[model samples]
Target: MSVFGGMSKGERNRIKIRVRTAMATQTQVEGRYLGGLATPGDGSPLIDAYRRH
Candidate 1:
C-alpha cells in the first residue's frame, strides 16, 4: 500500500506544497551563498522554479 493512501488528495497536496516551499527556501539560501550542497532529494528543480514566483 502507498504510505499516504489513507490521506485525502487535498491533504497530500498540502503536504507536497509545504515541502516544496521549504525546499525552495533552502535552495534560495544555498544559492545566495553559492554553497555547493546537494539537497536531500531529486536536486532542487522544483525549488528553483518556485523561487521565480
Candidate 2:
C-alpha cells in the first residue's frame, strides 16, 4: 500500500491544498522574472524561451 493510503480525507485535502499553493507561488516567481526580462531593450531572449515551456 502507498504511504498516504491510510490518511483521512481531510488530511489528503490539506496536503493537496498546500502543494497547490506552493506550486502557484513558484509559478508566480518564474513569471515575474520572465516579465523583467521582457522589458524593452533588455535584449535577453531567455525569458521568452522559457515562457514557451
Candidate 3:
C-alpha cells in the first residue's frame, strides 16, 4: 500500500485540498505573468497558447 493508505480519511482529504490549493495559486500567478507578457491586438504564439486553455 502507498503512504496515503495509512492516513485517516480526514487527513487524506486535507492533503488533497492543500495540493489543489497550491496548484490553483500557481496557475493564477502564471496567468497574470503571461497576460503581462501578452500584447494588445494579436499576440505571439506563447500568449495564444496561454489563452487557448
Off by over 4 Å in 2: 1-7, 32-53
Q: Write the per-residue lDDT of candidate 2 for residues 1-53, one digit (tens) a residue.
A: 56557567669899999987887787788653323334457664444554645
Best by lDDT: 1
TM-score for every candidate vs. truth? 0.43, 0.43, 0.43
| lDDT: worst 10-residue window of model 2 | 31-40
lDDT of 2 at 40: 52
Residue range with the least summed lDDT across 10 consecutive positions in model 3 = 31-40
Q: What is the C-alpha local distance difference test score of candidate 3?
A: 0.67
**What value does the lDDT take at residue 47 in candidate 1?**
47
State the lDDT at 21 in candidate 1: 88
Of the two candidates 1 and 3, the one with more favorable lDDT, higher being better, is 1
lDDT of 2 at 35: 31
lDDT of 3 by residue, 1-53 (tens): 56567577769899999987887788788753323454555653544655655
lDDT of 1 by residue, 8-34 (tens): 776989999998787788878875333
